[model samples]
Target: MEVLLSLVVGALVAAAIYLMLSRDLLRFLFGLILISNAANLSIFVSGRLISGAPPLIEKGQDFPVGEVANALPQALVLTAIVIGFGLFAFALVLTLRAYRSLGTLDTDEMRVAEPKDPS
Candidate 1:
């Protein structure tokens, strides 16, 4: 299972890098999302995969009697997801505003600081 997950994460990272190198702003944003998800998945896999057990201890016992899943990675992933959503939303809004103002989504064409055809 870990091997499969590692392969999936590798694929996601590769795709994200490929998309990130594109000249389109939208593709870059998608790549950013993919990379973030890949990171979260990597973290999750690092925590190990235990089945049929929650990350909780019995009230009477100080420690769990059976194998339990790690909670830190889960919490970290949850936090990362919330933060990623907010960042993605802000980036999307910024991109939309740039598109509205510049009328282009291409990074090269959206260079307002450098005019292509000078007047």
Candidate 2:
């Protein structure tokens, strides 16, 4: 299970890179989202895979009776998910504004600030 998850994360990162290399602003935005999700997945996989166990102790026990899944990664991923969503929303709005102003989503063409065309 862990191996499969690792492969999935790797694939996601690769796809994110490919998308990020595109010339379109929307593609870059999607790439950023994919990479963020990949990072979250990697962090989650680092916590190890355990089944049917909760990280809790009995009333008289100092530790859990059985091996339990780590909760830190879960919490971290949850937090990252929220943050990623916010970032995505902000980026999406920024992209929309840029498109409205510049009339294009191509990064190479959004060069109004450049004094001279490099071509």
**Cα-based lDDT for every prediction:** 0.94, 0.95
Clashes of each: 0, 0
Cα lDDT, model 1, residue 56: 76
- In candidate 2, what are the lDDT values of residues 1-119, reduced to their tens digit? 99999999999999999999999999999999999999999999999888848889999999888778898999999999999999999999999999999999999899898888568
Best by TM-score: 2
Model 2: how far residue 62 lies from native, Å: 2.8
User: Which candidate tops lDDT?
Assistant: 2
Where's the lowest-lDDT run of ten residues in candidate 1? 110-119
Candidate 2, residue 16: Cα displacement in angstroms equals 0.2
Model 2 scores a TM of: 0.92
TM-score for each candidate, following the candidate numbering: 0.90, 0.92
Supply the global lDDT for candidate 1. 0.94
